[model samples]
Target: MSLPMLRASRALSGADMHAESHAGAYADSCSSAGRVVARGAFARFATTLALTGALFASLVASPAVDAKTAQPKPVLDASAVATPDRYAADAAQQMFAAGGNAVDAAVAIAFTLAVTYPDAGNIGGGGFMTVYMDGKPYFLDYREKAPQSATRDMYLDDKGNVIKGMSLVGHRAVAVPGTVDGMWEAQKRFGKLKWKQVLAPAIKYATDGFPVEPWLQKRREFAAQNFGGKTNFDAYFSNLKAGVVFRQPELAQTLTRIASDGGREFYEGQTADLIARQMYGHGLLTKSDLVQYKAVWRQPVTASWNGYQIVTAPPPSSGGIGLIQLLKMKADLKPQFDGVELNSEPYIHLVSQIEDRVFADRQQYMGDPDSYRVPVDKLIDDAYLAKRVEDITPDEVPGAVPVKPGLGDSMPEKAQTTHFSVVDKWGNAVSNTYTLNGPFGSGVVVDGGGFVLNDEMDDFEIKAGVANQFGVTSGDVNTIAPGRRPLSSMAPTILTKDGKVSLVIGTPGGSRIFTSIFQVMTNLYDFNMPPADALAAMRFHHQLLPQKTIYFEPYHPIDGELAEQLKTRGYTLQGQTFNGDVQMIRIDGTTPQPAADPRGVGVGRVIQ
Candidate 1:
């Protein structure tokens, strides 16, 4: 079938898409005070009074009834949460109802996803968190670390060639996880509820079981086919089917231990031993590595664009820096995009040109700051960005601007990462994105730990210039080394206006994460679209390596005219499914407006 024909058949109008996306949402808005008023009845009475001049004048002269005196207002004005699953969203609401804040809700949601959305929400994986509290921005780096026995060429053949799939599958692919530690650290620092209080819901779900959704059931079938006898995957996940309740008693026990004894139980206690045993002869991780694992609190990367502040994850994630560059470059070259309509042929071309350059810089200069001395300041400098786009023009494609790192000498980061955005009534917000590198991680479930371990080893550059599973490449700055963190594309971002959080947003799409975020930001801030329309809008991605290729979501294919124009400009147009699963919340006044990506079966709820 032709591309245009397919688009016409499948593409939904903005209003239809928004309605369909939120059809499964738990609630549009809920008031906790339990008081209900009939606005329609009040309006009818007011209309009747208007018909009688004397009565209307008398009513207008009297003071209006004080709502507070008539009925007590709810303790919380408003709060919101958006996640990739309905179960996780419900868990977050549970924490909020218990007097917990955004941090507590986030911790609860993450643990709940470990049981319900195992594809990416995992306790055995690692990721970054960007927090905004009390007008200050903070970043947490709990990304998985390479084990002590890791080497520069651990995934290479003796003949010096790359060993395909070695870094992607099996026990050898596992890395020391950091999610449990990360959650613990976040709660200890900012959470209001007790640790056990936040974990109660996840334990209940795992012990009693929840019905499997279609997405999760498909993942189970895939795991059975690909990892049937490779590990203990089948023993744990093979029996799950759509519409059936799936329980994990072993995982419940593990969560129970961690809740009772604290995060230490997962590191220095019995859970650590189970992980060590799982990797006994097939992997390099050990009990010692687990004992030494610590999630670090890092300074968030912050930059100002127009009037808003962009606070996002810093290196080892190339996202924060890369996002800053994309915005600044677009701002610098504003004249080129002045008259171009958004998503129009000219606008996409200009954006793609800027994206290609930023990604080229990402490949050469991004990595774990702890391992490499990344030249962050030099890379995102205003002068440097201006020079990078000096040659860009609107009418024609510029000859190859050398695809090299912008700085003469620089330092330095996929999909399956799940993101959830939360906001409490107090205005505190948390944007978190974590992953296991791929679905079900390395497909190796620990004997007693009962969770999948991350194959984050594949995130490192197995060989400089060679693409990993996500088609993203990196330089020597990201080579494997003991205790070193791998470069990541997980960009958990928060935008603040006038020192107050205005938006909380992030997504999971491996290499497409940051770019997807970039587009959503433009859709909201630049085009002034509603939150639902912004999230439901079609998206595009352009990484540097694939020459002149640009990928768009297959379900929301590009317009025929736009596609033809892009092709005419020496660009290759590719349609790929599932561009991103973006979970976002925009704070309008004191109310939080939440929107979940229509592409995924997620939920967004507003609590009043």
Candidate 2:
């Protein structure tokens, strides 16, 4: 099963708590690390909201934060393969130049970033991948599964209630990793490039080192305490210095092994032994667990919204079902989806109501199929979905959002994750989201080798009501069980028109993953905005529990006093600079226009 779907919970608003620290505490260190703001936090709104004292005061005292320096974009036409991040793009370009097709290029890009971009994706983590080739979608079950020792009660206390908080810090939280086999089997099925060729880009970055982008460098500083301590920090963060370039020799070496020998090295060879030994030291994983790893392939799920077919990450991952449910709830409303306007309160409110109603079902009925029988079809059946929408009151008040009675009140989780997208010239598109729960996952570095183990165990539903790293919650549908894959908010997707591929997309944000995809789709297919403008826009999100919209001021302002007014109705308010890295490719029937999210330190370019 995928990692246990422990619910996500909002981390402490670290808003007011970290405001001073964000500006002062890390200023010197960030500057030293070559980290610039990348982009300043968006401006604050003028409102008499209860949180106004803190919100307005911070803005009044601060100048706009510095934006990160912009990297150059590829000046090209549509046929060049488009990837969300630069390393992935470079990897694909190498394959394309070597006479490899999009499938080979994409595989190369995915493997390359697995070494270079480790915050969210890599061998430590696993996810679903949909290949658009052979004129049909081929679903691969690469999602991770629970261990042989896991059981239905793994996450339950004697009384059966979920243990509190993120399942991150311990050994019990991990599931068998399937990423290696998933990628290998995928290449066998569709990749055109030789295995070693696909692995080269990652090998180069890991060995020679890739410069730290502002966002990645900033994350290291913000979450330094979490990713590493004074001990063994260099193993994962080698050659990195503020304003100084860093290289990943260890990771490059690991990739070289995989490229030449295959993923078995990570599961059965010396590298695998290194990982097992480390896990044993930490009391978290065992060799038996790694030996049992296998990838499963399942069908992708879809729902039609105004003639456009939206495909998403399916079960094991609750995202696909969750997204359809939310859209179902709002199916009747005539949204002002004209792509030209900035995000609005009505948009935020509708999404919140949809979230509130759908979460109840998600918590009760979803889980890894190998262990639990989720009523997927019924859950997404139009009739059931319509009822979910009916629960919406169309008002911004707290209780107006619906929840299924008897299910415990919902919570949220927020783990940092990564996303990548690829669209080959042949029209096969792949959107993927992967994560290790937190930075430098588990912080259990492989001795004498590069790459950190995943703290994905924290991704389980350990404690019932407490917020984990990401604000999320989990219960029966997502509780840990042997062989069960945890529920996830990772919603990688593709949008199609008349049964043909139209656009491919994916992003990085824990609980916000759902909202980010939802909004982006609205902006594109519904709002009809251009790639860059759609990406640069701000966003707002609400998971049933917070009860209030979490707004990014610059783009999602409530307009008028509705935001301030919502406070009296029990809405919890919080704000942040723009978040979510949405990398997408639009095949407008004639050409492909790729857009990379400016909010993150990712690079996406057309393959020359």
Candidate 3:
């Protein structure tokens, strides 16, 4: 069947909702990739939504956030891309210059990171992609999946106590990756440039070598401190340092093969063999596991607030749901914030309060829908949100009121992840958030493939009701299971005004991804700050557990009087600047204003 027809067929059959047994046999050949819009498909979908009007509003928009106001000055009308590293962004622009669309640029960007920013970027890790084409959205979940050998209590010891590093520090921590398949699917179905051309830039960098910046050097130092004596770390990163040229000749060879043979080479051919062989004695991965891995095309979760539509990656990622819940609660309680200063004690307290409560709900309910039913519908339900607001005792110190999660349950560390935003002149935009799970990722580089493996296994709930290293509490919903995708806080989001793409944003801060993205959006759309200011603004975060403690970025604007007020209200404050780096692009009219967050060494620019 043709790509769109295939998508329609799967959508109709409901088979695309989750993976089925024996699916690996035909998934790659038929359903794993390709959702290419058959010429008129997008138009049909758009018209259908327009015709349905308010009936589709629930699916398309939420009414909590205010509408975006008009920009005061004219902005550039051009394609733009941003990544946590400069070279990756340059590679994305190169793809755009080669006549690639946003999907192509994004694919190129993702691969380039694997070469240039080896700390977080990888062939072994996985992530989520939020794509917008002709004002419609598509979610591609390339997030890592557990191997067939994985079990729910694997992280627990014989005595049933959680093992501290079992899930975070070795070959066994690796999950079957889906990034290659995900990018391939995007390019095959929606890319405007040749796959080979898209892979060329990354291959060139990997083979020819690229200079390590101070940030990369710092990352190398940190990895050395933690994983110094390990064979895997020494092999791939021992020689890495600032000003030194870093090259991945083996990775270059691998990319060359992938560029010529397609991503199948990585999943089913020599590359897969290399990964399996290297991980054999230390982990459970096998060539069969690689063959069975598939990247699913999901539907983005959307919420309407402030006259604009917010579209983000859905579950297995609690980021979007938590975002929607927090914003909805904030909007529901707007009457209380009227005339209050943005970062004033009252305003800060309110946002923190919302974060605490929403995170509580997330810990109880959100997880991989294929493994468990994540009551997303009720979590974002209008009535339920209103009740959550009513339960909030805003004036009292937060912990004193004992705000608990409402009915229905949900569902660390400096994130060793990278995010990039790309918008093409054709009005196609993609926000991709991916990771290695830890800096250098289990510190295990695939033997001959020259790529680090992800420790995403640690992302699962090793101990029920306890918070993981990233300060995210978990339950059965997030427990590990064979073939199940683990929960992630990667919120790659796209915003639309009326019906056109307005903003694309994402970040990499483990549990802080959602809150960082949330703050940036509100700063731009709600508070009307420019893209730079929006991203550079000081940020604060509060997860539900370890109640009453609010973490803020260093020298955060809230201090003195505001800090005093927060303290008086029973909130404990802690500050740190390394929350997460947010890369964002504000698309107003003709130009896409891209902002690389200053918190990290990212760079942003428009591709002419």
The best candidate by lDDT is 1
Clashes of each: 4, 59, 23
Comparing 2 and 3 on TM-score, the stronger one: 3
Q: Rank the candidates by TM-score, best first.
A: 1, 3, 2
Residues 1-608 of candidate 3: C-alpha lDDT, one tens digit per residue: 22334324422211111111000000110000011322143234233323433432231122211247331232337788878777777777666555566887788788888888787877778999999986688999999999999988888889999887778878888899888888888878887555666776675565446777787778778876776565466656666777776655556545655665677778987778888898888897788999999889988898888888989988899988988887788888888877877777788888877887788777777788787777777888989999888755457567776666787432310007889999888778999998888887777776556677888998988777767768787677788888889899999999888778888899999988988888887788678999999888878888877888888876355688778988988888887646888898888677789998888888888887
Which is better, 1 or 3, measured by lDDT?
1
CA lDDT, candidate 3, residue 398: 77
RMSD of each: 15.0, 15.1, 13.3
lDDT of 3: 0.74
Give per-residue CA lDDT, model 1, range 236-331, as digits (tens): 676567887765545655665666567777888777887899899899999999999999999998888879999998899998888889889999
TM-score of 3: 0.85
Model 2, total clashes: 59
lDDT of every predicted structure (CA atoms): 0.77, 0.58, 0.74
Residue 173, candidate 3: alpha-carbon lDDT: 85
